[model samples]
Target: MSATASTQRPRLGVTFWLLAVALVALYAILVPILAALYGVSVPVAFLLGAGMCAAPLLALWYPRSSVAVFTVAAFVLPLTVSPDRDPVWPWPWSVPALILFALFVLTLTMQHGWRLGSLALLLGLMGSLAAPLLLPDAASAGAAGADLIVTASIATVAFVVGVLLAGRIRLGAELTREREHAEFERSRRELVEERTRIARELHDVVAHSMSLIQVQASTARFRAPGLPDEAIAEFDSIAATARSSLTEMRRILGVLRTEDHTAELAPQRGIDDIPALVDSTRRAGAPVDLTHEVEGEISAAVQIAVYRIVQESLSNAVRHAPGSSIGVSVTTAGDDVQVVVRNTPVPPSDPGTPGHGLRGMTERATLLGGEIHADRDGDGWTVSARIPRQPAATEVSATASTSTSTTTTTTTTTTEGSA
Candidate 1:
């Protein structure tokens, strides 16, 4: 009953309201005029007309009000017709009341849906048919039965049509929403498939190559007889480097395979690990000097970025400026950490396509809201970055802290195993 009393609908806007108001004014004038011709009195005729006009407009937002008004109007208006006339609705509700009442039924159906519409339709039929039976002049009135038939038939048709149109409109809106959801799901599936394919390619090609390097470097001493101590140490350093690279490659593959957060197995290298990294390069017979200045604790994310920036720079130096005195300097000032790596410029011997290292460094700095620069400094090439301290993506520290964490750092426990 609460729902039937009134429904809150989206306003059809000013133009629609203006059109509806005009229609109501037209019916308001004509119904009373026609009722007066049927011997209905001045005051009663206008009251009936007002009831018919109000029923339809109220149906738009107030179902119970429309039903009450239309039901009463349908029953009372019929008895007002003169028995001398063709009582088949008199001025015939056929021309006047029939259409106005039908409008009420049609609007009710559209606004509140069919269940309430059916109720209104049923009640309208009962009221319209019952009124003429109570008419004192109904017995002698010609075609009075036909009047009831015509009124019922028109209202029923309006109800049936309203139901069909409402169902079609509702179905159309539902289908549009479902189509949009399906399209989004399809796009997401394609993105996940693309990432999986890239991970598979790296595992098959890059991982296999790094594994071979580790195996060869590990077996070099046994393969060649009477190798010098320095050369053996160099081979051991190469093997360690290969193992470390393979480990890092596995970490990258894990990220590419899926978007989910997975447990990290090993600790990442950072500022403290810089000394060991330089020692390994020195053992490989490349002259290198390192300097550092730091105060207070730094975040794991910044530490990892700093370590990778330095590592990539050292790598570029060894390739483009081999056997040249390379300088690595790292320091912290306030909230920012700065790194500078310089080496003798290549002797016009190394010139070709650029690598992804510089791009990688720039992207890393940008992600952490920082900056990186690579430029030629006199006869030397320099790569530098100024990265602000930021929290890590995960709780895992860049380097192990306690006795228990140290053991996990060396253990291979990731989903993507070593190369």
Candidate 2:
């Protein structure tokens, strides 16, 4: 139970005890007074009254024991009336018995649900009807057959009503819970549909534009007559870069277009592609100094995360801090790979604003059970990431490794010449 519900229990207990005490006091006074009027002994009347109150008193503390307690009280009540009386039944106690019966039904239903409460109600009705047979004065008593029938009928009606009401209450609560859950699921599905729609729109616009740029750049290199070799080379480089971006964009769009999460497509770029990334940044007019001291082969997932972090950091620097010298480093310490990218601060004309790139980098690192930190470092900005490296299940081929190494060397030489 919640704290508020737990605290209310004591208050409820106090209220029940107070109500039980008041009812017992009323019974104690009334029964003895009526017996005195009938010429019965004061002691016997008070004792019987006390006995009558015992079940309800026990019910105040042990509410679950109510059925057993009421059964005993029902059997004992009839024995209290005088044999010489015209009406041998103790009809005055009938009101108290009805009150106790109602209390038992309500408490049992609330605590144990309808099934047990209905059982207790059935037992209570039977016990009440059988009470007359336990009377010490039964041999001289007047017929109570009509009275018994009326009382039993009334109790049965009340029990049916109580059961129906309890069933309705439980059904309503269950429906409310199911409705809330369905609403949550509906909202979640709508959110996913909205995301898919946005992704498709972005793919249509950006991918088409990039593809057109690549085609135009390639066409310009061959179509233009007497063009300088340098200009043709620059155009070729632009086409290559655009083609690379289109490939990456398609990979991302493929993920967005499909609902099947386990669907696989082309392989992704990773750490081996970082040299090309740096070369592209250099071609875009930002000088980058690259360094690495990694020892063992890292998983493709970790390599991809590291490469993306570096790529985004460099892209941000080029956009917001043009003409700034950037430094990139990757080093491994035991089982962890560390990446640091730092660039000179942007001029006053290119003031920084928080964007999605930083958040994406952070999310990537966190997904790999790692962390990234980006902050202003004196006159520059620095991004640092630490990713735990897991071993790959299989080793990459020697041919692929040699090709990547040669590409890295050529890219480094080109970056040095441009610098």
Candidate 3:
């Protein structure tokens, strides 16, 4: 699981094809010459040289086994080859075999690690070196002097070179993995830092203003002379609502409360608070008629979105159409919560452009796997939202959900948008 899985076998590249061709040429050219010099049948010479050529390729799968076969053939061939054949070609070990044996040692060393390769080098040298001793007169190059040295040197060099190259390849691969891991960690750290910065800024600016509002509202009764009981209660409600908003904002930003501040853990306003909202708006000058019909359990996220959308709609209606009767309805249909708010139609007093409040409502509805549609009806502007009862796993679900309301002007722009 640490590495990505490969589904198919890798294809052999051009390097492998070229190596195979070189091995075949060695077989075709050397077999006839070896047969003539070995003083043996063509089949015998072919078989002996074949093991040397095949050993390098087979070393990929069975390194020790190929080494054993190559060693046996190397030992037997020197004894069978005629002593008086030729002095020009290397004695005991032919040139083709010398090349092939070195290749075998290199392949074994790289693929199977240096331990097995060291063992193979020792075994190969043993058979080739002992051939001259066994048939002292058959050493066409003066009794195992130069030929023995040549074979031993070639093998040792191959092993040493193979070890160095293999180590380099392994080091490079390890470095690549380490670099990728470091980059991933750095990106994650940057994301966390950015989120913290955003939260701090919001707390410094927005939290400060809300704190002032709550304090002023809470102390209004003391500042005013002989305030009525109902007026005092309304100011207290405003203070309590402000405090609740501050607590919720802190929770959302994941900011810890200080020693002077206590975590309120207040519940958000939901369906039950709609009547109070209507009453407050009526007191503000806009008369609102509200009806509620909720069924099944609704997620806190969906409830909050519904409440905000309603709150914003009412505020817009009151601001733009004071004394106008606003109709608000909350109901559930199967797996969704439905909200509809309609305000009395009036020729838009301002330019019919979408405002921040309208955008906020659209964003809230869209945040939970929901859609909001705000358009003009014959009588007035209607702002409706359909949000799922259960919250979605991610905001991706919100994007996937359908919505016609991107940013409608709502109550402020009655001529062009919804309320």
Candidate 4:
């Protein structure tokens, strides 16, 4: 245990012992006063007071006999201790003490537990009050009654304060536990979601790489017997493709390991890179028809959105319906760019392939304040994406058109001079 806790144990023990001694002392002093006021003989009064003190000691040593002894003495002692030589209707000054004793006994019965040194202290107190009533003197019972009332009132107030404080402590502990549990659950959920997102990213990046590797390896194996030189070239291509894929995969994985993600992500590919995307698809043995109308500069965010939409749509088509003829279109009208990718469905050969391509495409578009629609059109699936464009930075188009006209006039003049 820490030094503080170790120190607290002895302090608490000392406090309990001090309280016990105080209770015994208070009872011992009060009993003699009460007995003298009621004119009891010194010896008898002392004996009676001593018995009251001994009751709690008995209760401390013997738990079973303790409560019974305390209860019976509480009720019988007051009646036995009359105030006057000739007993009268008004009982004695000891009545109030008896009442206090009964209430203390009731508390004992209700608050019973393994160790209650505090309650034992209170019992000794009640026992002390019983001494005066057993005396043979004539005394005013009203004053004694007032003292008992005051003592009981103070105890009741203390009990209320204690209960309120305890309730507050218990409530605070419960809230702390609940908050900790919530934090734990939140962390667990985030871990699961991060793993799932990484899996998706890995599939998208590595699948393309693996496909290239597979094609090259197959070509090398098939050409080995017929063309030795070409087969070696194919093996080299396979190794290069695998290495490229490995590099790209590392770059993608690194994005997930940091708090600042801007450094980890590659520059976004966009509509301008559509030619490259088409070339890749064509190399993969898919027919791609391209339609381009947007010529103006576009925002990086919008371009990225456009690129992702097309990328996901084409990826889905290639995986779900290979060898399908795809038509890709891009058009910009004022402040908006629209993309459409449609592919004719291929004949089903492979089984158990489900469609998540459309969902991925939709997720990309929706994240960028754009919308994508993928639906069946006759014998094909068509995906259309519309993204809002950013405003132009400058009127570079006007300057370019004016320069082109000047060049045309100059060319005409030169032609006339040659003639």
Candidate 5:
């Protein structure tokens, strides 16, 4: 058994208390008979029986020590308390032996695994075999020997049965663990397969469609003669944006397709790209007013997180609240950047069910050690996020320090030469 399983305390259930009560009752019954057989006072027999019975209770706390205590008691009890005249040598040992055997079996079952149980069985069998040697006279020795043989046979059978049962229990536990591990492996394999299928669909269908859009937008001016210069410039911008989106899509797909994919050659977009995103939204017929007051360099991860949150919020507004003026504000204080996006409410309509867009935004923010809140504002819906900028701030500070040290050295050298 594992160390964790072995060291854990056993629960004291109803059956445990019942067994303890039964043991005390058995001692009560055996004490009177023992006193009568030994011609001893009732109190002395009760004391000896109580001591033997109590030894087993110690197994509840210290299983190995209790087994030893009980085994020793089994041998010593008969020797100390002599039977009455015309004694049957084994009769006095019977009650103590029964208690010892019960405790031995109980300990074996309660403890995990087989090693300890096997040891308990071995000690009990040895104790049973040696019981006849403690007989007080040769005449009684013959009767004790016969009793010993019968008792040892019963104990041997009990030991074999206990070992078999313990082995079965261990086998069951092993099978349960194996089944759970197999289920986990199956689930992980299915997830990876599902992700790969999604990557393939996006690459084949979405990427191909985007590529066509980029190609058509790039060639539109040349194919249609006499196109206005402004129209040509618009087409150029469309092609550039489409190409950038396709590149980003490819990087994402590559990651899904392989575990060891390399980083993309192009840098990821950050908070600085939010203005361009807002401009695109405006071109798409959503009037977006953006206010950005962030004052320090932020990590690329935090930038991406902020950009995605704003993008999702704007997309939701356009889909659900078209013609509504959207307001996006990004501000930074100390090592934290806050982003709030709100849109004026349109006429009440089916808001549609909430879905992955909001959840994805929340998850992205959380991964960056930030938090996002999305709720209904007065006559509008609002989404806000707070992100940490400490990583980028540290890098920027280190760079500034290096530059300052270099300038100081140059100035010091120049001053000394001039002196």
Candidate 6:
């Protein structure tokens, strides 16, 4: 229970006490009147009158209208049979009781707050005690004045205490509701954040790898006629790469809630992975032609970009025009790697086909500060990407050797061909 309930408990105790006092007071006032009118003894009259207070208690325990109604009834009962009742007009003790009952009834019906009915009932007690004083009889005035001061003061204190207690109860209930709401919002926010993180990781992983695979597959198809066994080996490598990429992607997303604190898994495909990508698509039935002009070892970031551009274009060819031939070219010029992929026009294909090939490629190229274009070029669809590369040892070797001795170049090409 809240503070309101705790405080209200004492008020309840006081109300009951006041009720007892009212019964006794009315009984004391009635004994003389009953004895004079009906010749009954004081003891009998008092005993009989005291028994009437129980009616109000019963009503209260049963809770008919409001506790105040029963309480007022208890106070009013003695006024009805008082032998001092004047024929012209009775001592208006019943008026205060009625007023108390009305106030309680209103409070019960409206129930706006704690003040109205409880205070009204307390004031009624005061009014009842003061009634005889206003009659101008010295003895009656003195007795009524003393009685009113004592009883009203006690009842008023009880009413005020009850209101304070009730207010506390209301405050506690409001706080509890607010606490629950805050907790719910916190849980919901955590769920949203978790989902967003998963999405970002997925986008980073799948798009990059898929683009590399597509480009390598295109290269393998183009070089297959010139070199068969070597190209076939590349195809096998491409399959393994694809499967590995798929596996890593799944693992990253799987252990989201568990924190093992491992270093982030390195992305499986970089720029160098393009050869395997082209090889895979060639084996998958889309004939891809690839040519590369690079100085030497391209930077990993630049390699990844070139890989994605060729990959997306080739993947688009396979998806949008399944049997179409694709052409891929990569030129690493100083600070940039330019890659272009063009495929035969797709015959009227189904518009509803769902393929992530294009989206994956686009996401990859964009991440590396590169751009891709897919449009109609004469009789086929063409995709192109330009990526910036950092100068490295492999870049110098790849570029310088392309222009030098034929034997060294052929041997070098053959070696790259074998790989």
Q: Which candidate's TM-score is highest? A: 4
lDDT of each: 0.66, 0.62, 0.68, 0.53, 0.62, 0.51
Q: Which pairs of residues collide in candidate 4?
A: 38-137, 81-134
Across 1-419, the per-residue lDDT of candidate 2 in tens digits comes to 45654654674686567757766666766575547443446676566556445644544345456657666655555555556665644342355555555655655555446776677677666765565666534433345555555556655565666677768767976899899999999998766655554554454345445644565566564445778989989999998999799768756765665452111111356777777777766655567888766666576667766877887787677656756788888777888889999998657676675544565566557756788999889989999999877633232211122112112222223233122
Tell me the alpha-carbon RMSD of every candidate.
14.9, 15.6, 15.7, 12.4, 17.3, 13.7
- Candidate 3, residues 159-249: lDDT per residue as tens digits? 9998987797679768987999999988966566555445533553455456556655666676576899999999999989987997788
Residue 71 alpha-carbon offset, candidate 2, angstroms: 32
Error of 2 at 299 (Å): 2.7
Candidate 5: regions farther than 4 A off: 1-25, 36-62, 83-86, 89-92, 99-103, 106-114, 125-135, 225-234, 258-419
User: Best lDDT goes to which candidate?
Assistant: 3
Q: TM per model?
A: 0.44, 0.44, 0.47, 0.53, 0.50, 0.39
lDDT string, candidate 1, 254-353, tens digits: 6776643211212366677777766655544456777776556676666666777777777667555655677888877777888898888566667623
Superposed model 2: Cα runs more than 4 Å off: 1-161, 164-176, 179-183, 186-267, 391-419
Question: Model 1, residue 30: what's the lDDT?
Answer: 59
Q: After aligning candidate 5 to the native by TM-score, how far in Å is the CA of 44 from where it should be?
A: 6.5
Model 6 TM-score is 0.39
- TM-score winner between candidates 3 and 6: 3
After superposing candidate 6 on the true structure, give the runs of residues whose Cα lies further than 4 Å from its correct spot: 1-268, 291-313, 329-340, 350-378, 383-419
Alpha-carbon deviation at 310 in model 2, angstroms: 1.3
Model 5, position 124, has a per-residue lDDT of: 63
Q: Over the stretch 1-419, how does candidate 4's per-residue lDDT look in tens digits?
A: 44654553553465346535744775667476546544556665565555554454443335346555554454344444434534332333253344334333333332233134246436544654564455425335665556556655554554444445446656876899899999999997677556545644564555554654543353444434566777678677776776577556646555543331111112346666776876776665566787766656566656655666677667667656755688888777776779998988755464424433455455545544567787778878888987666623241212111111001011100000000
Q: Residue 120 of model 3: what lDDT?
A: 83
Number of clashes found in candidate 3: 1
Q: What C-alpha lDDT, on a 0 to 100 scale, does residue 61 get in candidate 3?
A: 59
Superposed by TM-score, candidate 3 places the C-alpha of residue 101 at a distance from the truth, in angstroms, of 1.6
